[model samples]
Target: MSLKITFSLTASLAVLLSCAAKKNQQAEADCPPKPCTMEFRTVGVVFTDSKGDTLQVKDFSVTLKATGKKLPSGAEQSTDAANPFYMIASDGDKSALSVEGDTVVVSGTHPSSGQVKKTDFVISGGRCECHINKVSGPEKIVF
Candidate 1:
């Protein structure tokens, strides 16, 4: 009788320990102890015509390449076609751009544009310094 009780107790203890170990292992796998940090920046230029006339771009797009990642966005502006200059602005820490008066400024760090890393977070601005000319018709201008 003593031998049977001892064996049963040992077996029960082993089963309980195995279950506890499994639960702990599953919890560890479910939650990662360390999180990754990602950062980026956006850089580009604006285009204008020769007669100081701002060209109206129907659909403007920008692409940033880094870490095999591509980020794209569009711009909106007045449809007068005479003063049809559009400005792009960043929305959050992820990245964005905006227009201030005659200058177009880009904010945030793009992975491919400059020497930025995931560890170092930064925000910057660049001007699309272009000479303007008379707007005659529809055209594509790059800054």
Candidate 2:
């Protein structure tokens, strides 16, 4: 290509990349300071036995990533890692949430399934997290 044509193409490419980078940075800017930490109580879990009976336990803990999100009201919310499907609430409950460890433990009620206790609580999948806004996954239920 001619020198002038080559220069024009290079400049155009640079601008396109810059624009794309800016857009990406803007999207991530909603995150609270890097490595932001928060705690959430009330994470739901399911432990079942072979007899179709849920395992009764005093506490349950699991690790998960938490990220920050921008609410429609211009507010900020914490989500599980890079996915917004799992939200971390501010209201501190019995649920023990650890950002550093990326783990959470929920306790209080004895383990029981909807069919076993006539309640609508069951964890069919191995493990999953769901947002409290009612964005529950087909494999998991986030109460």
RMSD to truth, every model: 20.2, 15.0
Number of the predicted model whose TM-score against the real structure is largest: 1
Candidate 2 weakest ten by summed lDDT: 122-131
User: What is the C-alpha local distance difference test score of candidate 1?
Assistant: 0.37
Query: Against the hidden reference, what TM-scores do the models get?
Result: 0.28, 0.25
lDDT of 1 by residue, 25-140 (tens): 77556543544334332222333544544444333433331232222332445456655544332322122222222222222222233332111112232222121221121232
lDDT of each: 0.37, 0.33
* Candidate 1: 10-residue stretch with minimal lDDT: 129-138
Candidate 1: deviation at residue 99, Å? 20
Q: Supply every candidate's count of residue pairs whose N, Cα or C atoms clash at under 3 angstroms.
A: 20, 2
Q: Compared with the true structure, what per-residue lDDT tens digits does model 2 show for residues 29-140?
A: 6645544235332333343345544344322222222332221121122233233222222223112222222222222223444332111221111111211221222223
